[model samples]
Target: MSKSIDYGNMMHRAMRGLIAEVLEDVGANGLPGEHHFFITFDTRHPDVEMADWLFDRYPSEMTIVVQHWFDNLIVGSDGFQITLNFGDTPEPLAIPFDAIRTFVDPSVEFGLRFENQDGEEDDAEVVDLPDLDLAEALDLDKVEDPKPETASDDPAPAKDADVVSLDAFRKT
Candidate 1:
């Protein structure tokens, strides 16, 4: 006789439970100190909307940092609404829980990543990030790209780009 276990099913249920807990706390006004969310989600989901460029630019996953300037965060049984400061503009967004692709709290190292329950047209994409130096953070204007390394007589070795895996992680 053979018995089997399905970790995928287990993981899916666990993630669902975690989301419910967070929403419950939000409803009760029990969000702990300095614990805002960095939510990355699908722009094309039925419940999400933005300027058309948002879908064209980040059709799969777009991360929004919700720390300093976010406001009007209201929770409901089906979804939530919040206001985000996009540069000089204040944009109000209403998002269903189903639209969430990822949630991370850099302050506590807590993170949650969600998969598209329905089929996805495109695989997720992550772009190259510039080094978070003070100079780059302060400069809102464009900066020139660094020149490619030139070959020396010693013939230095080349390097490849890195791939960050989202697997092996779950919200704590």
Candidate 2:
């Protein structure tokens, strides 16, 4: 029998490490410039800690925005803790790194998605992130459109922007 390398698991570890490093920096110096994050994690994870109300509301998975009003960000080797406002109610949550499903920073059009490979039934639904006007978010008057073929005299819509995928780096 031949042994095969587990590239998928390796990739997940590296991506999680990248997330950890970014959060660590943010925890130390605060969010720099206009960078913000939309982190989605599995609420059902055994290590996840949140208010009972929150658990009731988001029984499976929940997405939180780490933007202007977040506080008490503490990143650890296995997880992170943060306090986010829920309709003026401050709620602290502890999320293990392994529970994270997706992380996105629309300010710079960066995103990461982690898929389940353990053969467990993944009941998480596709989450639609709020559309962001990149020009307004970045305080830019005009942003160049990457697709010249579809270019028009009018400024390109933010939704028309291209998102680079990790698959691009994979060997065929």
Candidate 3:
């Protein structure tokens, strides 16, 4: 069997490049007009460096707005550094591209979401199902048959081709 290339990961990295480019621009031109950003990142990521107190406050994740308050912005090849006020004290923050989860510019309603590869906050509830053949897998007698969707007294609206029915994969 041929191995499939991870195009999804490649695409994600490319999208991250967009954030880098925008940061570089802001670093140079100093955030032209109302083009600010709401950057959300995983604080648990190892490359993310910040003040101990700040990390303690935001133990899992944090969002920072890059507007009028930030200074000393440096956009590097792998990461970015910036200084922001934290309770009257200047706190320098270093955030790697890998730590970032979402970047948005509410000025234009543009945004991008990235997968957090650090394995942090994995709250997905996993349920294990028993292995069995299709016939033995289903308890047909215990399952009630689905009633047919009756035609309405008024003529039913046209069904859109884009609409999907999940009944095929349902246990019943």
Candidate 4:
């Protein structure tokens, strides 16, 4: 048998497309200049959580921010949530590990994406805050720094890379 499979590397490369999809959304709306995001997601995949008390809550991949008066912001591989200051009040939200859609820093042109994690295993594990803070996830300075924006005067943001073609993909 002379078959070798690099599933780990393959998964990483395949995931870049997913990340691109999320960034596309940011360019469309979130990019207003020097604005960033505090995206929280599930490291486990699939099993995302929200407040059981809210009726409007829907199980989806969501991304929040710390652009304004956000406090107690936390980031982990699985998911993230924070107390966004809306006017004079603050609310604490805890999102499931899998429900993160994307995190965009429009100030530069950098972002990342994640597919919803499947939370098949519900185990209690305390995650630690990494040394590299969320602010450095990619690089705000690189956000919205791409040159194509200057080339065209179109106000509308760029769209995500089409998956129908391999033109946007690269082999790992």
Candidate 5:
């Protein structure tokens, strides 16, 4: 039997690191030029901590917008903390990186989705990541080389260059 490389796990780790990078940038310097984050996480995850009211409201999952009105946004290696208003009261939350289900910066149309692995019995499931076009994230406008179109009678379907796939590493 051929061994399949666990590209999915590696990609998940990389995407999480990317999330950290974006958060670090936001923590150091305020969000740049309309850049904002829509972060979703599993509330039931062990590493997540929030108010009892919030858990009652969002029993399974919760999504927070880190655009405006958030205070003391601190991004650490393992997690992040921020204060947000919930019904006129400031609610502080501490969320670990593993509990994150999705991270999106809609301003640039960039996003990432992670598998909800908490309490899962199967570790062999492959994770499907979203379009990871991070060219805008790293500001690599002048450095990237444009792709050359292949000559064919049939025209190729339109697709964004930012979308990447890991199928090549999977065993057939």
Candidate 6:
């Protein structure tokens, strides 16, 4: 009998690594350009950690949104720890990478789903949620920042001017 490679498990590991890298970046630099994450994990996973009330509420699976407000995002090789607000109460959670069922970023309309088969290795599935408008779904208004100064003594230029002009040539 010939042995076959476990491609499904290999792909799952790669996908989890991708998630870890993204989380690590966010933990270091913060979310950029309105990008955020919706991470759903299996609450029943042995490595999962959360408040008892939360576990009781979500007994099987729970989805947490990492957006406008989140704190203490520490990513480790095995899992990650994050504190999120739950109805004005901040709750800390520890979720193993293996427990993650889905990771979605609505800003760019990108998502990944992991399917676990009867306690066997997981298979990755790319999920595209097209028609999902985050702005309307979240019901939040967009906040625009004022034009940034270009390290110049003169008055700040207009938004369009700043965009057209390169920073290197701008007056200091």
TM-scores of all predicted structures:
0.54, 0.69, 0.65, 0.39, 0.66, 0.74
Once superposed on the true structure, which residue ranges of model 6 sit more than 4 Å away at CA? 131-172
118-154 per-residue lDDT for model 3 (tens digits): 4543211111222323223223233222223322222
TM-score of 4: 0.39
lDDT of 2 by residue, 5-79 (tens): 766667777888889999999998888888887677889999999999989977987767676666789999999
In candidate 3, which residue ranges exceed 4 Å CA deviation?
117-172
Q: Each prediction's Cα lDDT score?
A: 0.51, 0.67, 0.61, 0.38, 0.63, 0.72
Cand. 6 TM to true fold: 0.74
Clashes of each: 0, 0, 0, 24, 0, 0
Q: Model 1: residues >4 Å from true position, as ranges?
A: 1-14, 20-31, 116-172
lDDT of predicted model 1: 0.51
Candidate rank order under lDDT: 6, 2, 5, 3, 1, 4
The lDDT of model 4 is 0.38
Best by TM-score: 6
lDDT of 1 by residue, 114-147 (tens): 6543464222222222323323332313222222
Worst 10 residues of 2 by lDDT: 162-171
| Model 5, span 1-172: residue lDDT tens | 6499777677777778788888888777877877767676779889898999889977987767666556677988888997765544668899998887767676776666665444652122222324434444323353222244322223543211221222221234
Native-structure RMSD, model 4: 14.7
- Would you list the clashing residue pairs of candidate 1? none
lDDT score for residue 83 of model 3: 82
Model 6 Cα lDDT, one tens digit per residue, 1-172: 6399878888889989999999999999888887878787889999999999989977987777677667799999999998875645678899999999888787888878887778677778776567645454333342223233232224443221100111111123
lDDT of 1 at 46: 84
Which tens-of-lDDT digit does each residue in 1-172 have in candidate 4? 7389756445544454444444444434444455554453433234543444321332332334435334444544443444543222355665543344444443554444443234432212212224334344434343322222221234444322100111111112
Winner on TM-score (1 vs 5): 5
Per-candidate RMSD, Å: 14.5, 12.2, 19.0, 14.7, 15.2, 13.5
